[model samples]
Target: MNTQTYMQKLELLAERSISSYSYIHSLLEELKPLLPFAGACCTNIDPYRLLSTGAVVAHNMESIHHQLLTYAYGQEGVHSYDNMTPSHTSVMTLHCATEGQPEQSSRYQDILQPAGFGDELRAALLYKGSCWGYLTLFRKQDQSLFSEQECQWMVEIAPIIAKHLRQFSLAIPFVNEVKLRSPEILMLSQQLELLSSNSDTHHWLDVLRQHEGITTSALPRSILTVASMALTDDTIFDQRLHTDCCSSSLPCSPIQVCVPVREHDYIDITAYALYSHTSSIQLMIAIQSASPLDILPWMMEDYHLSEREKQIVDQVIEGLSTRKIADILHLSPCAVEEHLQSIFAKTKTTSRRELIARLLSQTDCIISR
Candidate 1:
């Protein structure tokens, strides 16, 4: 194995110099010479549903990618990750494997083997001691199994991977230009309108496959599948402020997504209802940035801002004027100004633009234990 090469790559990743598109795909290829895995996948899972919303999978296995989007998670209660621990496991050979048998499971027979993988190793991506993401490597059957020292090597690098990944996923960057004019209305504007109005899960899936891209009239099938997997039916029809109104506050906005095939690229997707249709929900994609408002709650708690102050901060980031914020929140203009002053002081920012820059420039991601 090339230890020197591995260390150099690790150092680069730690510096966050790796482009978003190559985050996992490029890293895995470098590690493969040492570990000798023919296939790999890196994933970001939603803690609530334990579903992978975004993933980077081996490009050669395009069909396998499809299965990944629809495949029921079989690793649950099967790996140390099920308990949200930082550990690595060889699906069939690990000593602590308590599940019936990894190789005998549906995931192996239906998904792994069909993709030409004979054995699988899952490495945990834990943050603050809980599994938030994962890295999986696959080897052909003719290859020898992974050794203990290699597994140890994986364990040693887990923290570095987790830290940078967290930064990458939550980054909205310190953009000189922060546009809030509302994302452009693309070809799916009509479908987005329909979904926003009703948010029927079935219709949402169909609409995903039909999104117009920069050049093409519709997105690629694989991209659509990735979007489908990321935008869960439940998350789409989430809690509504009113039955007739659009989706209420997302737990977090601009969901973090990893498109592995696209150079391990990361994108943040936010849904909005356009025009006059309150229920027509359309997805707005930020190619490599998080939504500025998504980072506000974390700042609010850190700076000890009150709920009213937090609301004002959110509106300010949304580019609303003091008068507009007051109107929307039903607070008097004087009260809104008072809250803004308190927020500015607490956040140590002199103006609305500075507040957004401070928050978006560097806010930690949430990773519950």
Candidate 2:
């Protein structure tokens, strides 16, 4: 099929309300005809920190993820996903970036070459300035290098991919309703290896690995990103800190992040560096369900709600009646009802039950602008 036809298929697929994993999996299958690759890795990026929240790997790309993350956080490599500007055409190839001498890239020399991979095409899936994820396509040494024309085509559809990823971030899965369990614990070595984990870790790990395209043996990119953050020197990581959590005045202990596994259920991951008298020891990670406090911030930003509206939405999620919400906020019942009306309008729901269901359940087929 031609590029236009393939893109049409992608557009149609993007319109469907599906899980992020399903969307990404189908997207890769469709891209095969337009831009073939030996292997690929689609990673969900935390827009705030530009960190990998999860990843979907096809073919043998999973083999190199550990090394890739090491290089990604270790050095400023050529065409780093974080460095790429968020645009419809935010894409680059190692050969093009290195002016045909791909050897100039440390990632190419250290990671790609050894993996038997050649040219790499990477696109940062950014929607309206927020990077939702990334797509990295790899060709084998024997295969032809990705042409500039192909890179341009990827640029054209990059925004569409970003839009779907962002939309799917809020999509509710069709899976059985499994409320997030209590906090689980895990221990990791400085090298980012899983040293030990409690029994509860399996439940969370299974959910993460099942949805995140990770094998049982491999660490999910979310865990890897947080664990890496804990081990990284503050001096080096300070340059990359995008949030205010690392301000000099405040004591930042364990680095914590709320990873959205589905629409409303978020896995709160906190990584702590265990240090001894002389040096740092193993890294400890606590995993659990994110409270409404944590989930509301993302929902408010995505829905573009005001602070008061967010407060109401929080109470609505708790099944609070308008009168109860008003009592808590010291507002009259009429005022609370008015605020609820606005909240429903902004969230595209009609009644309180519908609004609550919208917040708790999967998203509709509404595509983001």
Candidate 3:
């Protein structure tokens, strides 16, 4: 098939009503003809933090995730996915980025070369001014390098993939009756190995696996992504201090990620460093269903609410009257009413009650101890 026809097929594929996993998995497979690669890593990124939230791997690339992430956030490596901007070229091959000298890339020297891989092409999946995920395709050592034409093709199709990823981010998954109200705590080694977890942890993990359609024994990609961020943050701290162990009483700062998992349901995952007396650093991860407050900002973003609209919506959710909200924001009651109407139009709700219900669906499932 011609390149233009392949591009059209990809656009059509993105429009299909499939789960996120299916869409991305099939996307990688379909790219083999136009952009041949022996391995690939496609990961959903937390748009705000620009950190990975989940990933899909092929050709045994799963084992290198920790190291790959390390180099991504490490001092070395150009064209890091996190550093990508809207103005920057979002798609580029290592050979091109390094001026045809791939040896100059730390990631190539440390991760790719060791894995017997050559010429990596990376793309930041962006749409609507927000990055939804990242794509990295790898060729074997004996394979030819990625050409400029191939990289340009990736740039053209990236937004389509990003749009699908964004749609999937807001799409509701199969709702399971079983729910864990309290947060489940998990301990992990610095390498992100699952060390232990609360009794309820496995139940929640099962739910995640079911939703992601992953049947493997490996730790869920979301959990690892969170853990990796925690480590990356600590690593940054350690760099300034010139020490591996944090001398302070407090553990490293934590990272909290909230992602939609099921119908009107979101999961909040919190990860932080745990320093034992032995000076060994472990990662502590807490997983629980997102509270109303936790999901509010995400809903606002999803609705594409303006700053004023977001403030008004926040007050509305807080059960404030129009006059009260107007007084607080120093806006006339008429202006506040007008903003409410706009919000209603955007959110597709008629009344304040309906708006709140739509913005903050009853996703919590709390049980008495």
Q: What's the distance in Å from true for residue 330, model 1?
A: 32
- lDDT tens string, model 2, 1-369? 666776778778877735777778888887876688999988887665677778888887767877787777656457777567543347988888888998888988888999999899999887766788989999999999999889888877887788778777655443235555666888888787788886668767877777586667677778888787766646434533443433332223677777777533666888877654333357888887766556555666577666788788888878888889999999999988888888888888899888766655543322232
Clash pairs detected, candidate 2: 172-362
The candidate that achieves the highest TM-score relative to the unseen native structure: 3
Pairs with steric clashes in candidate 1:
21-263, 21-264, 21-265, 22-263, 193-280, 196-279, 196-280, 196-281, 197-279, 197-280
Candidate 2 lowest-lDDT run of ten? 243-252
Which residue pairs in candidate 3 collide? none
- Candidate number that wins on TM-score, 2 or 3: 3
Better of 2 and 3 by lDDT: 3
Tens digit of lDDT per residue, candidate 1, span 1-369?
455566667768656554333566567766776677777777655332344545666746555755554443222243334543433331222322433355544566677766666666667776554344677777776776666677777776766676566555444333323232333222233222222222233332333323211122333332343334334434444444324434343331333433221211122333332222244444443233335444445345557677688778778877998889989999899999888889889877998888788877633333211
RMSD of each: 11.0, 7.4, 5.0
Residue 220, model 1: lDDT of: 35
Candidate 1, residue 337: the lDDT equals 88
Clashes of each: 10, 1, 0
